[model samples]
Target chain A: MKKFIEKIIQGLFTVSGFVTSIAILLIVLFLFTEGMGLFKNKLVEDGYQLVVNKQNDVSSLSAEQIKDIFDGEITNWNEIGGRNQEIILFRLNDISNYFTDEELGSELEFVPEKISELIAQHPEMIGFIPQQYIDNAFKGKVLEAGKIGFSDIFLGKEWIPTATPVSFYGILPLVTGTLWVSLVAILLALPFGLAAAIYLAEMANHKMRNILKPLIELLSGIPSVVYGFFGLIVIVPLVQKLFHLPVGETGLTGSIVLAIMALPTIITVSEDAMRNCPRSMREASLALGGSKWQTIYKIVIPYSISGITSAVVLGIGRAVGETMAVLMVTGNSAVIATSILQPLRTIPATIAAELGEAPDGGVHYQALFLLGIILFVITQIINSSVEYVSAKNKI
Target chain B: MNITLKKRRSQHLAFGIVSLLTYSIVAILIIILAFIIIRGIGVINWEFLSTAPTDGMTGGGIFPAIVGTCYLILGSAAFAFPVGIMSGIYMNEYAPKGKLVRFIRMMTNNLSGIPSIVFGLFGMALFVNKLSFGDSILAGSLTLALLSLPLVIRTTEEALKAIPYSFREGSYALGATKLQTIRRVTLPMALPNITTGLILAVGRVSGETAPILFTCAAYFLPQLPSGVLDQCMALPYHLYVLATSGTNMELQRPIAYGTALVLIMIVLLVNITATVVRRYFANKVKMN
Candidate 1:
């Protein structure tokens, strides 16, 4: 009977292992299918455009003339000096504009490529995009569509990714805010976390370590939304009074909150790595006439640099990927700031701020996905750095 | 002697800096806990727990969310643990040391790298809409199972790997079949670790919000879930709604804090219990 039961158990194990692999495969395949499905539909209505002739004839305009119309730094549609008619430009959601609510909704479902084609076919049409994608594709067909010429993105400093009252999805403010907040957070928390880690790993007695270590690790598991509310009620108010600001939910408040949120991750990972450091190295540094602080600074930090890097990256990931907490406190405004004290929005906060109202597959939706892709790329870069550093260390 | 005095002062400075640093971490933890406890003590009554949520957010109890959390956790475990343990077994026992094992190991590492939102998008595409689960508890539970799989496999594999190779060799020497020895000897000894891993998985699935946002969490469901396939209200989403949406700011403000405090308490309790359980087995093994 026992033999029979054992046979069944072994059979189950082999069977289930196969199933887990299948599940992961299915997940990857499904994303590709949904994302690619939009491209499968072919375009039939490759349309036409208006432009100025090289012969100085305004009636018969070329594609270049039409594109120049849209890219114009001109004040009026007529200021491209083209026709007497106000250039009643029409561009689709995909290439023409970041999607309006109606376009993102069921009213029109133009994939970005279709919009690109639409802009390509119409000379009076305008396309809003990076200058790189804008040229050649729509060069002969459409002009730069809006009144204000495309400004250098770094110089254009306002973000309103989901502004219903105003459609301003320029990400400059959000990008800056995310960086500013994360920079402040890492600056505040990293030193404190590393110091605590040093003490717990090297200096503290076993009982002191035992009581302290798990407590810190336990704190790591606490959710960010909790931290956000704690900040919303407590930190926001405290900062408001301290600074005498009109509102408490400023960038400074957001950073402090993120600092607290990032602390546990930095401490736990750094401490664990420190504890695992070779004992002989510490001894050698001490014997070299190095004081404890000098040894720690010169020897221990260099030894654990890879681990500390991982901790920093993880903390940054936590700060950047965080949505609900920062969203609640950063005043959810997408305006750029000159100082840390001003309220601002981050990319994640922008997404969380507007994802609910966004129509799926809309330009806004794609932009959000684009935001996801950007964030994924950034995190991937950080991760690659960790791997590169790890490989270099040979440890 | 003069050099010694200089060295001692530097040592004291290092100690001071380190002590100050540790005190900051401890101070933050104390402040957070104290704040939560002070507010939570006023909010967490038997009535608050037992009764259903009302029309307003502040007065309602979180019975449904709690029940939904339990239901999703149980469902996720039912789906994930068996398959995860099997994969671990395959790696440890049956699979030869080959390229396939190496590939599988790399894939597991890559699997951990995929962010929770990507998993959310995956769930949205595959389970929530494609499979027509339509934001039901089943979809949420299944996606969570997928999220839980890597953790379960990693932890279980480590646990199985830690078991002494001699025990398995002795079983083989007794003329036992590979399957027979694994079932009768290897599995029983590793059961404690498997339990510990499951406890950790529980904490993971309970707290995770990203995947379920697209698969499981309902924005407003006054009633409790009646079946596994039904839509559900979860704690994380409830907290999100109360905190983010301003339709009822007057009411939501207090509830958000109250819910957060409850969530922190529950997760802490669950984690501590799991740690205690792990230590129990570890000490027992040490004694033997």
Candidate 2:
């Protein structure tokens, strides 16, 4: 009976271990399955179609070209393999711009007729109208808006995910914004973190180390939302005042906050690495007439280089994955940031801010999931590399 | 002599720089703590701590959010501790050292490193939508349980590993079963460290906002959650909403500070308790 009970307990333990492995699999499965639903969606808004005069030669437009045309970047039809004429943009709202309220009749009863008539009158015009408006008597040809392609997301430039006629799911701005903030954060954190690690590991007395180490751990334990609140109340105003900027919620503020957050991880990890250096090596350096700094810079640091590298990598991981603080401080703008002073949006921040409002199983919702996949992939690579480096260090 | 003098000067400079940088970090921490305490103390009266929020969260207290965070912490701990402790025991005591073990360890590490927001998305997908729990405390707790599971397992394994092998061997020599040996000897010795890990997990679960933002967190629920299926406000999420997307930013600013202070205090309190428990236990073990 005891043996049987032991077997049962062992089975429970084995099953529990498998639970973690299965969880990782499930996260990947759900993220990809939901995210890949984006491709099945059309580039044009649902329930809407692009219509042009039958005389026009332009038959269809790729998602990119349509976005470019609507954004006013591509004004000539010739640019997109169409007839050599200026492209005229039209939307449902543009009907009111061309016609008076009286002309459209009460309750806009003549909107469909007037829209078809307007499209027929101008060969260069492309109208984005409701599918219901394009009936059998419509004088224009319907243009097929192709489904969203992979390049429209990975390599595309714009990230306006809720634009009318078509929402841009281009990830360039978000990717670059995330990279910029993380890069600056690492740049700011590395010197300070390394210095602190060196001091605590080699220089500080036991008492000082005890107090300071726990203090730093306490720093890490503080919730990120608190850091964000601190940033919003204090750093934002300070940055604005110093730079004379219109708003303080720039990439720099986010970098500063992330740097602060990353400090404890970097310091703790690197300090442990440095402390692991053999005492005999330091003694030999000092016995050979080497200075304290020389012994550290030459022997201890080189010996623990892999550990320090893994520490920095972990710091980078933290900075990249942080959501709440970045969302709170970084002025959530979905533009490709050219400078640190400019406001930009990060992938995690964008997800956190937008996922609440995105309808379930919709294209916008799928796009956010795709962003999650990108983040998951990036962090997985970082984590696996950290694992590899530390594994190598152990060997 | 000249080279030696130059080396000494450079060493002094390097030491000065590192010491300055280290203290500056501590100083910054102090400034942050001080700033919050100074600004938030006025709003920390009995009314603020005990009453429900009023006037669209501009007046009254943050009692509901505090209670919600407490529920989440308890729920996550309940789900995570048994699985985590058992997994740690399995790895340390039962599982043979092999490639499979290495693979499981890698997966655990990767899971922990996955962004909290990704966990939020996963929680929304699995617990909220797929499982049809719909935004509720149960879903949020399960999500947080996943997030903290890796930490708990890692710490528990370390705690178990710290116990000397002789105790287990002695139990076995006395004709005890493997489970009995572990239950009576190793687990009791490891309990204090495991408790520390549990406290730290509570600290983490309390402060998490992204994972609960969609799974369970309500912008402002007038009443406390009476069931696991109900939505509730959490301190971190409440602070985020008030700071970023509140009805009145000006009125909510002070309250946001108060909320932040409360959050920091709870996390710090939990951390201090963990540290004290570990220290006291370490000394006790040494004395024995």
Candidate 3:
């Protein structure tokens, strides 16, 4: 009986041991399965079609050109291989502008005919209308938009995932924004974190070290949303006032907040690494008449370089993975940020802000999942490198 | 002599810079804590803690969010603790030292490092959509459980590893089975550290927003959750909504501050408790 129970218990533990590995696999699997489904989706919004005048030369528009035309960046039809006429943007609602409500009827029964007429009348007009509004009898021709391809997402410029005619899923702005904020954060954090780590490792007395170490841990223990709150109330306004910007929420504010958040991880990890340096080395350096700082810079640092490198890698991972605090402070604008002073959005922030309203199993939802996959891959790379570095240090 | 003098001057400068940087970090912490306390203290009345939010979260209090967070904490703990402890036991006491163990360890590290938002997405896919749980406390708890699983496993493994081998050997000499040895000797010895880990996991789970945002968080449900399947308000998501997406930011700012204070206090309390538990256990171990 005892042996049987032990067998069951061992079996249970073995199963539990696989849980985390399985979870990691599942996360990747689910994200990819959901995210990769985006490629199978059409470039245009579901149930919507692009209609143009039959006389127009434009038969097709790539997702990029459609977004550009809609955004008014490509005002001339010739820019997209059409005739040398000005591109006129039209939405389903734009039909009202072309005709009176009485002519369209109260229930909008005649709206489709009116829409067909409007598109047919203006050769330069590109109309985005519902599929219900377009039939074989419609006067205009429908443009065939291809499935959303890899380049449309990876190389596209705009990130308007909810735009009516075409939802752009170009990750460039989010990718750039995420990298820019994380880079700035690392640049700001490394000096302070390294200095603080050095002070604690080399200079602080035992009592001071005890107090400061837990205090830093306490800082880490503070929930990130709380940090977001603090950032919104304090750093956002301060950044705006100092820079004379129109808005308080900017990439700089995010970087500053992330730097502060990353500081605890960097300080704790590097300080432990520095402290792990053998006392014998420091004593030998001192015996050679080297100063305390000299012993630190020459012996301790060199001895723990691998550990410190891992610490820095881990810090970068934290900054890149950080979501709530950056989301709250970074203004959540999906623009290609030109400077730290501009408001921008990161991958995590975009997912957090937009995932709620995205209809389940829709193109927008899958696009957000794709963003999640991108974020997951990036952080996994950073983390696996940290793991490798730390493992090497142990050896 | 000139070279030595210059080295000394440079050393002093570097020391000054390092100390300044160190103290400035502490100062920043102090400023954040002080600013939150000063601004948020006024809003934390008895009514604020006891009442449900009213009028689009502009007035009243954050009672439901607190309850929801508590439920999430409880539910996640219920799910994570047993599995985590078991996994830790397998790693430390049973699993042979090999590449499989190393791979498991690597996966744990990677899982812990994956962005929380990605976990949110995964949870949405697996629990909310695949499992058809809908937006519910159960789904949220499971999602948060996965997020904290790594922390729990690592801490449990560390705690179990700290137990001296001789204790297990002694139990085995008395004809105790492997499970018996662990249950009767090692687990008791490592209980305090395990408790500390569990408390820290609670702190982490309670504060998480992204995982719960899609999995369970309700925008405005003044009433408390009636079942595991019911969607509920969570404090972190509440603060996020009020701070960013609320209808009247000016009116809701105070409540947002109050909710933030409540969150900070919970985290602080958890940290202090874990520290005290660790210190008490350390002293006890020293006495032994």
TM-score: which is higher, 1 or 2? 2
- On lDDT, the candidate that comes out on top is 2
- Those runs of model 1 whose alpha carbons end farther than 4 Å from true positions after fitting are A1-75, A81-173, A336-338, A391-395, B98-103
Local error of candidate 3 at residue A21 (angstroms): 0.6
Model 2 stretches with alpha carbons more than 4 Å out:
A68-90, A93-124, A132-139
Q: How would you encode candidate 1's per-residue C-alpha lDDT over B173-236 as one tens digit per residue? A: 9999888777799988998888888887888788777667767887777788888778887877
Note the residue pairs that clash in candidate 1: A49-A123, A51-A61, A52-A61, A63-A140, A67-A142, A67-A143, A70-A143, A70-A144, A71-A144, A94-A112
In order, the TM-score of chain B in each prediction is: 0.93, 0.98, 0.98
Q: i-RMS values of the candidates, in order?
A: 2.9, 0.7, 0.9
Query: What does candidate 1's lDDT look like per residue over A252-326, in tens digits?
Result: 888988888788878877877776668898899888877877777788888787789888987887787776678
Each prediction's TM-score against the native? Answer: 0.80, 0.95, 0.94
Candidates 2 and 3 compared by lDDT, better number: 2
Worst ten-residue run, lDDT, model 2 chain A?
A62-71
| Candidate 1 chain A weakest ten by summed lDDT | A38-47
Give the Å error, residue B54, model 1: 1.4
How much is A265 displaced in model 3, in angstroms? 1.0
True contacts kept of 3: 0.85
